[model samples]
Target: MDAQTGSTASAFPPGFPWGGAIAANHAEGAYLTDGKRLDISDGFPRGIKHEYDAVIDPKKCYPTHEAIDFYHRYPEDLALMREMNFRAFRTSINWSRIFPNGDDDEPNEVGLQFYDSLFDEMRSRGMEPVVTLSHYETPIHLVG
Candidate 1:
């Protein structure tokens, strides 16, 4: 009997954890602002994968430069996240954004301030922030 045969149908419990995420090299666009500079990500070309050298040219479109412009639009973006009922928003912190050249004696003040505001916005909207420290946005100089 259909009523007699019963089993759990869902994989997770109700109100299960759910969220959205983006890496620093994928969504942020403040690569040159606030005492920032090139990271390894700046070398990758847009659209498709290719040899690193082939896409390193500057004549072609760069993905990070206009990557959703999240660096500037995060407040609005976070608001949208709240609308989606996101339990947490995960995004990486561009290493270069915090410490330009990856060897500066002091961290960039503007860069530090940006994150303070970002996290505040998230908490204010009842959304938790999950930040990544160096997800492929490592300063290029450090690598070289």
Candidate 2:
């Protein structure tokens, strides 16, 4: 183990992959752009620890509203991840982005395109994407 980093050199076997993960609601920030609509995460002004507002209070600031701007800056961000030698990335698919109403008969095409591009970007950078169908951010329309 290295004294400074406290990490053993070659701790795992050869070909071991290293990567990072992120939740869609915590990264994607195009909130209502395109055909997307509000989801459960839209009301958490102070994260999951605090009580979510009964409705979206425009007065309160929500971090997920613009979290990292990853939705738009993913190319640059994925490049940075490649620079760090990340071989895999785990991320969720924002359910509401695809089915804005949760029960919609057809999916939103633009949303599908966004993810297709995102996954293609990762593959282009030699990063394998591990995708989750959904995270905690359910479409608000379903709750109504």
Candidate 3:
């Protein structure tokens, strides 16, 4: 066991959660482009964390707006993750992506299609995809 990094390889029996993670806001960047609305994370200038109602820094670049372009690059990324022995991939499905503004007349089919394809790819590689409901990305309209 390494004292510095706490590498506990021999401690686990089997089925440990070896996973990669991504927030919907930080990874799925089709933001408001495909019928998506403004999620709270859309206003978060800091990619990691910020106030619940933080005002976005207009001058600063918004990383979440692009967010590695996961919406379009999941296939290549997931293949890399499989190569890394990632047994599970964890990612939040952006609520706004599906519902537009949290409370919509109906769910967005395009958003649902994206997740379906993503999970299918994961399953094909024998990887489990853990979905988070809200990863600090509730639609901006819902906070009030």
Top model number, TM-score: 2
Candidate 3 is scored at a TM of 0.82
Q: Model 3 misses residue 132 by how many Å?
A: 0.9
User: What would the per-residue lDDT of candidate 1 be over residues 24-128, giving only the tens digit for each residue?
Assistant: 778878668878878988877767586354235767778887788888999889888889988888888888998989999999999999889888988898878
TM-score of each candidate structure, all chains considered together = 0.85, 0.90, 0.82
Candidate 3 lDDT by residue in tens digits, 25-135: 888787767788888778766544544335666676666788889999999999999999999999988898899889899999988998899999999987898988888
* Count of clashes in candidate 2: 0
Instruction: Please list the residue runs of candidate 2 whose C-alpha ends up more than 4 Å from where it truly belongs after superposition.
Output: 1-10
Off by over 4 Å in 1: 1-8, 53-57
Candidate 3 has an lDDT of 0.83
Q: What is the Å distance of residue 140 in model 3 from its true position? A: 1.4
Better of 1 and 3 by lDDT: 3
Model 1 clash pairs are none
> Per-residue lDDT tens digits of candidate 2, residues 1-144?
799898887576777778999999999998998898989987789545767875778878888788888999999999999999999999999999999999999999999999999999999999999999888879999986
Query: Roughly what TM-score does model 2 have, to 2 decimal places?
Result: 0.90
Better of 1 and 2 by TM-score: 2
**Top candidate when judged by lDDT against the true structure:** 2
Model 1, residue 136: C-alpha shift (Å): 0.6
lDDT of each: 0.82, 0.90, 0.83
